[model samples]
Target: MNNRRLPSLTPEQCGSRILDAKCIVAFTGAGISTAAGIPDFRGPNGLYTTGKYNADKVFEIDYFHKHPEMFYEFSRDFIQILKKIQPTITHRFLARLESEDLLTGVITQNIDTLHHRAGSINIAEVHGSYWSASCLSCNQFIKNGATLDWWEEQMTQSPRSPVVLCPHCGGIIKPDVVFFGEPVRDLDKAETMIKSCDLLLVLGSSLTVYPAALLPQLTSASTIVVNQGDVMISFRQDMYFILSDLDAFFKKVIDFIDS
Candidate 1:
């Protein structure tokens, strides 16, 4: 529980603070990508909630090793969707902030690589991304984003047991997405930024997951959260919560900033 108690601010006050603040650090999650046609993990129509796919098995390293096809099947669809989706207005706004040097960087729990696609250069992908993959046996690496297409092609040719093999040594190639048991990437650097920034903008996260979820507590910076649903953090003096559509909220904020 937080000891500090701060009353909620009006939208205008929130907008004003955002505009005045320098070194704003954006913390993001799957919810930020939901408007871009990506399903959030715990939402009503989410991949896990719908039971359309077994998320535990799909993201567990042991399960991945045993039934690689299951994970690959999920990845194939995810990658295809990535190719079609564009960055949302919220994403674009954040990128604009970065370009104008108003934002420090983005710390994201997303694996979609949308922040990079949105032109946010300073990003710490806490959960890693599909930007790269590596082979387990020989450590052969695939750096570019071309593996998704190759994986889809393999799945098309062999619907039953499609395997993305390492061309170097016939080893299984796995995307760098952090599994349940895997350690998150760049967390130390992210925490350093979170603790030091003048403003910490949390976007579309429930703040339920461990380690990453603990980041807000580590920051003394003024905090503002914009999300469509309930966020997990308790009210504090330096905190503000906006339960609204992220795109609409950010669009209004951008207008306020420009004004």
Candidate 2:
């Protein structure tokens, strides 16, 4: 839902701003991971449209409590998808910016952890990630380092066994990801970063989600949105919108910066 009466910017202009900025923060969403074979939430091939996966039951807390299997089934496929993909060009561009000290940090709604894998040091996962999980019964914690092995063991442990369960109390293991009715993770920190940055880069997000969507309003930082479609918010000043393929846009941006 875009109201296109606001001012627009070219890739070179946006790159010039980025090169001049002291602190550049990136805000990303599922669109960043779509090229990595991860489906967008409302996109055509997203979980909502797929007959095999029900978005309501997969993310709804009440539904999860009653039928956790539905979520685990989705998770199993999601984890497999992650295995087959690497970070996209956009992901690498942000990571390279971070490495060159041009980027302050990243604030992301994606749970893929692609930013982390791409070598971004500072990040805020507004929606929690699958990197870590905890036991619901005994509050037993599973560290990120152990997550993959643990997930693998459970999947092959038995055919009738639960997809994910606590080894200690046989309790269900819940990933740190935000479910429906759950508050976003690290909101306070994310807001602080957003407010402090000199530039806010919106990448691959529809900006339809609440609380997280309100972040841009909390800052007067120059905003640059690079995605394929419309974004919900339209700023009056210091804003730029580039509606194009993320990778192609970023390639142009990188060229502008290096030149």
Candidate 3:
């Protein structure tokens, strides 16, 4: 990650521009949730710290079928972390923008449902969420937090074993999160939002992940990126970059919006 900081406009300037825009779209990532006490699974002190579950192996559909316990372990920790946290100021601000009609929609790389909890009506989660699950055998879907708790219970009792047998047909049960080989969710909706947006705001993302990473490029709107470091994107003259802590920057923006 590049440690170099990019020049940023004043909070008032950024907020004014966002407020005045007819249609705004936000692309977000894990960084936006860090302030709410969730760890970035790809960051230094994240899952890499333990060196146990390989990202490639753990997220693969085939591997998950053979070793559902591994995914369950990770999910247990994640579910607990999410339960203890609330949406941060940045998330609330984005929701507020949506409520005021300043923002058209949000395209998020995050699987957490913080944006929805914060009252944002229009959201496109490129990555699927843990809030739901699917059964491979019966093709039935369940949407509830209790399902995650049940999965955790199964994991504790059957560690090092696969417990993916579907309830209806004894096949497999998978969390709704997009696995390594799985296609992202809502590709068409994401494309439509990007193409129709008048302004695009990118927050707290490295933009390394493909498909979702390329959504910003599809927009003809002016882009404003607020992240801690450099991301892979062709620099356009209309793009405004802000390299800083997302929570701090957004706090200032919220203040300006309120004023």
Candidate 4:
């Protein structure tokens, strides 16, 4: 998109655009949840690169099938982090927009369920999430998906469950998260939402991962990126870039909109 790009946008200006938009959709990444203590999988000090979690073992589908324990171990800690943290300002702002019928939906690459916790109902978790899990054997989802208490029960067992398994089939249970070889969960739905929107807000993502990263280009809508670091796409003339803190930028936008 080489139309006309603005290098920077004031919070008030962004707020004005949002208020004037009839349908706004947000595309978010792990950066949006980092402020809430959920670590990004690809950030500078993220799980993969930081050596805290092995991406090969955790995200590779074949590896997961072979050594489910490694992924389960990561899951144990991830659930704890999710339990202790709340959604960030940006998350709540989008939820508020959804409630007011201003935002159409959110297309998120994050596995963290903060968007749901923040009360955004029309969300497409393209990366999948821990909200649900299915058995390796029967391919049946945990009765009602999973709850914090369910995870707590599994993780905190006296001897600790070596692997989370399906209660019904006694098969290994895996979170619905998209593994390396797995296709993302909701691309078509998310694409339709993005294409139908008048405005697109990209929050906290570096835009490195694809094909999720390519969704922004699928829409001709005005695209605004709010990220702290480098994004994969070129600074196109048609898009807008705001290199700033996610929550900090949205705090100002929220203040303006709520005013």
Measured by lDDT, the strongest candidate is 4
The window of 10 residues in a row where model 4 has the poorest summed lDDT is 1-10
Which pairs, if any, clash in model 4?
none
| C-alpha lDDT of all candidate models, in order | 0.80, 0.81, 0.79, 0.83
Per-prediction CA RMSD (Å): 3.1, 2.3, 3.3, 2.8
Q: After superposition, how far is residue 251 of candidate 3 from its true place, in Å?
A: 0.9
- Better-scoring candidate (lDDT), 3 or 4: 4
The pairs that clash in candidate 1 are none
Number of backbone-clashing residue pairs for each candidate, in the order shown: 0, 0, 0, 0
Which lDDT tens digits does candidate 2 get at residues 7-65?
66787988889889998999998888877777665678766677787876788878887
Instruction: Tell me the deviation in Å of residue 166 in model 1.
Output: 2.0
Which of the two candidates, 1 or 4, achieves a greater lDDT against the reference? 4
Off by over 4 Å in 4: 1-5, 40-55, 143-145, 157-160, 234-238
Query: How well does model 4 score by local distance difference test?
Result: 0.83
Model 1, 62-175: lDDT tens digits are 888888877887777677878888889888888998898889899999988888788888888788887678888898776555444655665576555566777788788888
